[model samples]
Target chain A: MTVSVPHSLDDAVRLLGEHPDAMLLAGGTDAMVEINDGHRRPNAMVIALNRVPDLRSWRHDPVSGTVTIGAGVTYTELMQEPLAELLPALAEASRTVGSPQIRNAGTLGGNLGTCSPAGDGLPVLSALDAEIRIVSSSGERTISVHDLMVGVKQTSLLPGELIAEIDLKVRAGWQGYAKVGVRNAMVIAVASACLAVDSEQRRVSIALGSVGPTVLRCADAEQQLSNAVDWTSGAVSPDAIREFGTLVSAASTPITDHRSTAEYRSHAVGVLGARLARRAFATSEGAAG
Target chain B: MSNQFFTLRVNGADHEIADSWLGESLLDVLRDRAGLMGSKGACTQGECGSCSVMVDDSLVCSCLVMAATAVDQEIVTIEGVAPIGAPSDVQQAFVDAGAVQCGFCTPGLIMAVHDLLDRTSEPTDTEIREELAGNVCRCTGYGRIIEAVQQVAVQRGGAK
Candidate 1:
């Protein structure tokens, strides 16, 4: 019945080492609901890490072509000026999050902690080839977003390890996020896609969410389109966009769930992929991102 | 387990409540402990904005917030925004536009509109709808509620 608040990363790691079974509470947007519904319980202890200073900030290294977002950076914070400019697709996805209230409290780390396939930020992370930064009293480790999400609401996070931040490259390209949902707001994505067209590398990356067990990367699509599109000129033909869409849709291994059907999810993601690709082709601002 | 004495500052006033569960929601603490009942407890989850409040200038559903987490944070409930006998322009606008029916969702809506107006002086219809998407009303069909927002905007001379 103890709720432990740690103020520093060392203190947090120490708390985790001491109480390996304790539940880590960042924003508690999803954790609290599970506790209230009697679906889950924090055994013996709850480590409240929201107050930890080191986990509450972010930094961008222009020379390294990467941005490291603190685990505590909420959706509300992500949608603001500087961070939004650096990661516009993530910012765009953040806007579609539950509500202002939810955005205010929900954190990027919390979304990773939950590891839900429907999580808005996951596809963006996948598209960007993001890496999750994990820490413990023992040491620190980094894993790709592709490997981090093992399954639905699951991860490979070991005992006593806490996610510290998300690290991703700042691609010199066009980036956009689009989702199909039941409503204009506050609805879980039936299907969502994040498209990042890297002009400098002459490549395209597409990630789809809620259509499979995990946030899925369209390797076939990215591979095929990298050859088809003229990435140097930042131009993509409509035919290329359609071909990319078809490949992304084929990548999804969806199931019929309460939110949507497998066929519809497939179709919706294809459409979103095509639309975002076309949008990225026309936009000039994402090269600096 | 030890119970800590939690002190919360709400609407320019401080209140102390002892021996409360750490997992108790901020919505419950405001209504049950501090006796500020303006934010209703309709949905204990994050979906319904009936328990909306401002915590450190950020809008969040109090139901989703832990009371232990909200300590020392500045909180403004609907009661604080418009005290018992006195109503803010947003509150009066709801009355003027007949936005209240069952009246349970009004306080939260008022708080939401209040928060929105604070940020954007003259928000468009689409903007209003998008911002208040979290606050759901079963009555009034939302037509008058939208009207009420416009009423407040007009009454304020397109300024906050």
Candidate 2:
């Protein structure tokens, strides 16, 4: 076995390019569990990406209203950073992951790479329309989070490619994230929803996780809500919100799992979607009031 | 694994070892080789925070951490967090609050509280709950643990 620690991005790219069969190791929270459970084995080499400095920084691009989060930045860092205001839902989700110990070690990229249906970060990223930055020896490319997740525990990541950062458009709006679990903490999400309302743009986006093959946007529900309510007026009717929730429930295709029943997940999505939407609306009201 | 050698500064002590299994978890090495028994091995899975440790002032489960990844970093186990004779304020608070029911989850809970108080000197009850949510204490039910943290916050005058 080979363990390669590349400190620089160029070196990391070169190493990944050279060892196409290598497994990338970041926050090993997910990877280690898989390895221990005999789900995955390191091929001949393991590329340690933790040492690459550039993959752990966060910066805001004021001109574009975009915030770039390095893939190696841990959930703990996200919770502590001042920029968390831009993505409060993400911060809230981060707070729900594993524990203080898990948050310190688990990176956002690891969550994205795992691509689990119940991944806490996925719904937030989907709701935000976050862009994932991938780098290879040849060059770099960006893909939307929605397009990156292919299925359960899978992604569109190609061989010899590493996610460098996640870019999210910063919006001056209110957002909320909520998840149903067997217990309040450290458990995998039964079903999760993130709601973001771009009040300035007069649009709303809702993302659901653990209720489908991949994190999915509730496009029909969003359209219905957009057409039904004057989001600018800041007064969304309860019946309209309930209709949107029903539409979100229709969009869910959750499976029966040890954590929760499929029916419960579907039901929770609708309730959670409406609750999150109401919370976001309240936050918006608080900001405006 | 490649036989690369690196020095790990754990709990203020530097130890040199061959990095043959660079992909091996720091938790395993700390238990198997380094012989630091402070961090437990309850759930080799990351679910249990029994194996929590501080890496560069951040609390992380050692089981999920790659040993090679911890190279050139500083780590503080439950033993190092408090001095041998005199316990840290958080530890003292845990003892005073009678939070150590089974003592199995105490180390992780203490470390979690340490990190929480370090970052937020005056964390609200909700913030404390959020920070400690990752830590599971099947025995104590977290009542005393929360009380301990709150006691520390009160004593510190909300100083993180």
Candidate 3:
């Protein structure tokens, strides 16, 4: 097989334009496993983006309250300081990903590329209401994480297009990620939940993974919690948190797999959602006082 | 299929192989082409850390890295870490703590401990457990491995 190691973002786009069928290789954490398991056939060509420099940079815009992260940034980098300070939920999710070896090789872009409901990063992205920037030799387009992910292991990405960067609305407040699996680590999530409270916008968002075909958002639950709690007060009642968990549990339609039963996954996600929400609320209290 | 020319620098020594398969993993090329038998490929998948190595100073599962993508990258495998003659402190600690039973997972565990001590002079028991979470040993119930890491950490100016 032939491989194109593009050093520049433009070169990567051009290579993908030329060989649209070439498999896109970032960290190869997921793709290599598929190839090794014979679940995916090796393509004739691969567009290796590890050499691309621009895809590894991240920028924070204070005015817009946005953080643009290049698709190539590995989870290891996210776990480090400065970046971790910006996206605590993403950092928490990154820590849950496989082992240190896996985190070193896995990228948020790779997570998007796989588009798996079990992906730990997607729930955080969904909770943050992140926007994805897709680019090609033709042009560029921006889409929300909800619109970009169509289904399990599926995305709306065209053949010649690749994820350029992810734009997150970084807000003041607290966010947390929680996952339940058979093992403590190096295991796929049986159920995952991410909760982010934007005190500035008075918005509370929760996303659940490993419970549906795509990362499921609890918009109704979010609206209820957002309206029910006063962020400035920084205190959320126990009844409110319990109701939020119940609403989130009602929103998700999980499936039974060898790892966990549908009923168990639903219950776990609800517990995780409630736990994270409570932590976020406590963090708000810390910030307020 | 076409083969690519790849260069891997391990332990400050550069090794080049001609006509290496682009699809081959760094683990495969390291053991088969470079004849470095130190890193064991117990799980060709990334589940097991037996094939762990340091690439560009970051610890990674070599089996998950594409051989072509690893060109010009610095790799430190078990062979480079010990070099057959000079065993590192981490290895000595393992021997002292009786951490090696079958010895299949030693290289990965040593790499993990080496990484841990490099970052922290005195690591707590919890920190050591978190660091060595990837490398698994079936023969030893990890009590000895944790002890060996603690012993090494204590020796290395105390691993914080």
Question: Which one wins on TM-score?
Answer: 3
C-alpha lDDT of residue A162 in model 3: 98
After superposition, the stretches of candidate 3 with alpha carbons farther than 4 Å from their true spots are: A282-289, B18-20, B158-160
Worst 10 residues of 2 chain A by lDDT: A280-289
- Candidate 1 local lDDT, B45-131, one digit each (tens): 889899999988888898888787676689999878866778888888888889999999887888899989888878899999989
Report residue A59 deviation for candidate 1 (angstroms).
2.1
For residue A240, give model 1's deviation from the true position in Å: 2.7
Which of the CAPRI classes, incorrect, acceptable, medium or high, describes model 1?
medium
Best by DockQ: 2
lDDT of 2 by residue, B1-160 (tens): 3547767788899878664466677877887778888888788788878888888877888888878768778888887887788999999998999999889988888888888888888888888888887677889888889899999989999553
For model 1, residues A190-244, the per-residue Cα lDDT tens digits are 9999998788788889999999999999899999778877655766566777888
TM-score of chain B of each: 0.94, 0.91, 0.92
> Which pairs clash (backbone N, Cα, C closer than 3 Å) in model 2?
A99-B134, B121-B160
Give the TM-score comparing model 2 with the true structure, all chains together: 0.92
RMSDs, each prediction? 3.4, 3.1, 2.8
Ranking by TM-score: 3, 1, 2
- By DockQ, the candidates rank as 2, 3, 1
